[model samples]
Target: MPHDQLPTQAHAFLRQRHNELGIPGLARRWREVRAQIRANGTWRPTYDELAYAARVAWRNSGRCIGRLRWPSLIVRDRRHITTLHDVGRELAAHLDEATNGGRIRSVITVLAPATNAGPPPVRIISPQLARYAAWPSREGVLGDPANLALTRLATDLGWSGPTRRGPFDLLPWIAATADGVLHLLPTDPMHILEVPIQHPNHPWITDLGLRWPAVPVISNMTLTFGGLWFPAPFSGTFMASEIATRNLADEHRYHQLPAIITGLRLDDRDRLRTDKALLTLHEAVLYSFEAAGVSITDHHRESRAFARFAQHEEAADRVVVGDWSWLNSYPMTPQDPSWSRYYHPGQPTPALLRDPYCLALTAGHPKPGHEPSPRQRADVPPGRCRHTQPRKGGHVSTRTPVKAHRRLTRLAAAAVTLAAVTAGLVGVSGGPAQAAGCRAAPYSAKFGAADYFMQYDGVEVISYPKYPSYYRTTSQCRDIQVRNTGDGVDFGPFYACVNFYGRSGCNYWTYVPVGQWRNLATNVKDGTKFYVWVRIDMGKYYGFRAVGDW
Candidate 1:
């Protein structure tokens, strides 16, 4: 659409520029833009206009929680670059400048914008300039499950990864030009600043060998302003939670929590073990980045900063719009100031918008008819990539030999099992009385079995201790009843016991059917603690609740 025909957006942006920056002669500039649009059906944004618009786009981004530094964003206007080679070179330069040797700086490189003549001159196909490759096999996904499609697409484009693939393998950059050509460019390892994840308190965490990029450069979103779309790639130092809580801890992503919990050897007897593990992971991510001199922020600090940003916006008579879900951190606590407040909840231009073609390309599925031909495959030679090279300072290379990688995998698996067994004890709550005068608390267990139908060969145990002040005893209670709360097949013939430390005196095993309660006889004692042991025949998950008269 011509800017002269629908001049509302163009006029709004220009007026904002005038109001905020006090740029004189706004009416004269608008007339010039109108004349350009009348003659050529589109108007070009001057470098000054483009830079300010990019900064304003960050300010208007509803999903961003770090908009406090909007005015400090460094914008690179590369509107003249039209070739894929130049795009690759500029991207490498962007990484070097933004990374800044671990003291990351926020930067955005704005390429050619979409015009009436054609689409953007160059478009980045990767979701982030720095992302790991995901190679799927019969065993499991070797890298990130989230990037499997993209990994497969890269391989199909003749970009074979290292001779021995391991997790945390950096993917090659993919770019497409207006002439329908695809280019696969290798990322220079020196430019990719990586921080090895290690916990300050837990030294064993380093053994797992996890690392993350210092700066996250988002490449797939378009910077929309004044009725034009620019394929802009932007970067900011990571927020610790984005790496620890989401990227590494999410089940569909790296899923490192279970391993971390196992390494911590936290007793499952504590009801908050999972939460503790998550916090520990967050601390490790923060510590690792800080130790490496990489710029990072914790959730609490970022939330407080955002609160201040909102205050400043309100002071300026600007309505703060934000997506509440995105603004708050995962594993969020009420202590954060952002937890209690609300904001105007809609997206407003100028904004960074996700284009469908970019999304598809990032997902490893290009536009159906635009698939690259045989000649378009750009594969790098094996030894030429620096990721496969040995580190200079006696540091271990990320690319482990295939045999060593398998051995490490086996050790990790063993550690997980041992951790589960060592911390097998569960906690149950004593709450309000249910029917038959029994106080119940809900409990659930995650089976370690990989197959859904296969039975977890290990025993699932729960204990109510006597020494802990918070623990409830069966002294006042007579009989204990257990109800199967799971949706899967029935479980148990539970063994109820009264124990002193490791020794136990128990009764005969009593069976409990699905959704039904079974009263099991227990020998109540003053000093001994109560315990329940059950085994499920099928399913990867089990849920139950125990009720006793207290």
Candidate 2:
């Protein structure tokens, strides 16, 4: 049946899509939506939720449906998979009856490690395939290729995330709808479901949410695993005007072709005749299909695509890493090291950890290719080494010559202690006590008051206990120290560091080893006397400020 004969709910859903596409005459239908939302006073399935979802789904799908108007193929949509039973059954028959039968293609994207890093997981499946894979479907729903792809992708990403989560979960990005967009809750033992969502009157929830909770990472949030919500706004806003102009182009004749395609390899002079997209981000998919005669319009902008107009063909499939542990393969420096000044430029991505955990060491254990870790001897004096011949202690002797560069690594680890303060306070005590000229003195009441850490010229004894000595360079930091004393609060895996090199990079900087966020602030004692550096969490920025008597 046509859109007019559909029920109010289906009609509302259709109108929303129309409004999003800037389809002519859509406003008349949207009036109905505005009235419905107003009458309800609040949305269980609110307009805000619906609109936002549709918007993002569009972007996620590479704006194929979001930007273009397919005038050729007939488009029919139903709110729930059950609503499209006839179409589902028809599509089902085609898949089964077709010769050289091949299962539909699909994939999943999941967040792993399993937490405390990066954004949430994402899973998507085409509409037709979703129905065949979900509950109450008539076919072999359990082993559908699309479902397997989704599961494989999740497994590859190290998701190990709880399964069968749903509609009211925290990660709206992965919530399930009756529609086929993307749903992967299996009724079998392949995956277990987990959720971070709560009911309004749930025993765990308070009226204000904050009143009953001080931490909300998993306890108070909602999570919808194995399901996805379709969104249209992200793509529309990112490509709105560009698409509008294309739709008006004389050649396309009112089709909302993607704007980024003009520079593509496909010729827009004839799309109906070509059956292709101008410049799809689907580079990996296009090339694979191309071998089978599936050509695309995205000839130029599909940088991800291997096949160019020049005839470059990509491998069969673009590999998405199946493991999350690899993300932790790099060293995360929580502070500066004795070998060099600071971390290499952008040593770590924000996907790593909190900024306070600056200059961190991921996996804590090194695999062959992994970067070495920063030392962890904070209380040790600057430019000094405590050499105790270990008869046989579990704590490895970092000073052993057999260890090669381990001593330098130790001092680098201590360098981190200079900036690991919980409060945004940095103390600077510029005297022989903190620096000892070319050496570091142990913690003392008098010297402790001046928190500034130190590095000197000639021979420099790094702060690590087993770290014997390190030479310095000209205009190199003659000596530096944390600007404060006694605020050595240990925050477990959370710490920050500074190199006193300047607000950002300077001549004395080193490869931050592994850490994210550029130093947002730096000071030179009096802003002119000597430069001071700082590392901090982005949420709580603590610029380099002199606290003690400089």
lDDT per model, in order?
0.63, 0.23
Model 1 TM-score, 2 decimals = 0.66
lDDT for each residue of candidate 2 in 44-159, tens digit (9 for 90 to 100) = 23343333333322222211221222111111122222222232232333223221112111111111111112222321112112111111135433222222222332222222
Q: Tell me the lDDT of model 1 at 335.
A: 79
lDDT of 1 by residue, 439-514 (tens): 4442211121121211122223333321221223344445554555444433333333322222212244566555
**Which stretches in model 1 have alpha-carbon errors above 4 Å?**
1-6, 364-550
Model 2 stretches with alpha carbons more than 4 Å out? 1-31, 39-74, 80-293, 296-550
Query: Which candidate number maximizes TM-score?
Result: 1
RMSD of 1: 22.0
**Residue 148 of model 2, lDDT score:** 27
Task: List TM-scores for all candidates, in order.
Answer: 0.66, 0.20
Model 2: weakest 10-residue lDDT segment is 211-220
